[model samples]
Target: MTDVVQNGQAKRVSNSAIFAGCAVFVAGMVGAAYASVPLYRLFCQVTGYNGTTQRVEQYSEKILDRTIQVTFDANISSGLNWEFKPARMVNPKIGETIQIEYTATNRSPRPTTGSAVFNVTPMEAGAYFNKVECFCFTEQTLQPGETVKMPVVFYVDPEIAKADETRNIKTITLSYTFYPSEPGKPVAALPEGNKAVDKKL
Candidate 1:
């Protein structure tokens, strides 16, 4: 019965090995799934994929004489109780830095927080649109009936004028959509006896 005992032990060991291998594989897949989102965002930022624009701290000194019309669009996602819109349209020369404002008002009686997601139109133009400063980079919390004007400073990369695909393009549109921060989270009511702070737009 010694041979029988040895065969059973070998079988058990083989089954244990298979189970261990599957556990490791599953763990690896889970890790990869968790990492995919940030990785994809980084890839989009670098490549300007899907109309994702680039962020910069400063614009180049070279300003092209060519001018392009830039239109701004703002949207509020469903369930976000806020009014959002662009203040104006602008025509800026390539490589000229400009700042534009968007106003957001919290219409709900409760204090609400939102974060904006932005993109550029004519998808190929995204690679050429650069933002020096944008309020969309962070979350904004507004008191009840509060209004705030958020700004975005950006420029069209002068190099865009040299690209055959975008050289002839005369207009670009930047769009933003504000969504409630953390879906399903209850909005907190403004604290009693606290006056809403007046913020300059």
Candidate 2:
């Protein structure tokens, strides 16, 4: 009888260990996907983790013969009534500098200010992505119906071609999401399917 009890206890412990392993595996799979912005600023700016692009001043020293398509995407989080978008796409050679623009207009009846957070993908590409000039994190205040153009200057590092993890990338996407510059409000993920709104008052 004691042997039977001991065997049952061992089986229960084994099952508990299996369950804990499964939980850990699931958590690992979901690592930082929900961390969104600010995390990019705090933990990713230097290391470029979670697809956060690096900021630099000088242009790349070496331009490559290879070209990669760079795409742009924009989003507006809640509490901001602004329309923003990039100026389409460009295929830039590795280490070659390029400049692009994004237009933003206040759609609200009153003046509003917004800030931007940016990142790039296939996650690992962040370490190789470099931006020279950007309007991110700056407060832009526009009067009612006021529109303004913002430019971004950036390039992909030539070292990307040599890095084993990013060498195969053919396309990279640079994305930004704008949020209200209201003090004390926490930044959050953008809502789906609402890039441009007819919410003009």
**Cα RMSD to the true fold for all candidates:** 6.2, 9.1
Best by TM-score: 1
Candidate 1 root-mean-square deviation in Å = 6.2
Local accuracy by lDDT, each model: 0.82, 0.80
Candidate 2 has a TM-score of: 0.71
Model 1, runs deviating above 4 Å:
183-199
Q: For model 2, what is the error of residue 195's alpha carbon versus the real structure, in angstroms, after optimal superposition? A: 26
Residue 16 error for model 2, in Å?
A: 40
User: lDDT tens string, model 2, 1-201?
Assistant: 999999999999999999999999889767756564546455677888889888786899999999999999999998898998787989999999998888888999998877677789889999889987776735567789988878778899999999899999999999998888764343443211212222222
lDDT of 1 by residue, 1-201 (tens): 999999999999999999999999999999998777667777777777888898876777899888899999999999989999885889999999998888999999999888778888898899999987777766678889999988888999998899998898999999998889863332221111212322476
- Candidate 2 lDDT trough over 10 residues, lowest sum: 190-199
Score every model by TM-score. 0.88, 0.71
> Which residue pairs come into collision in candidate 1?
none
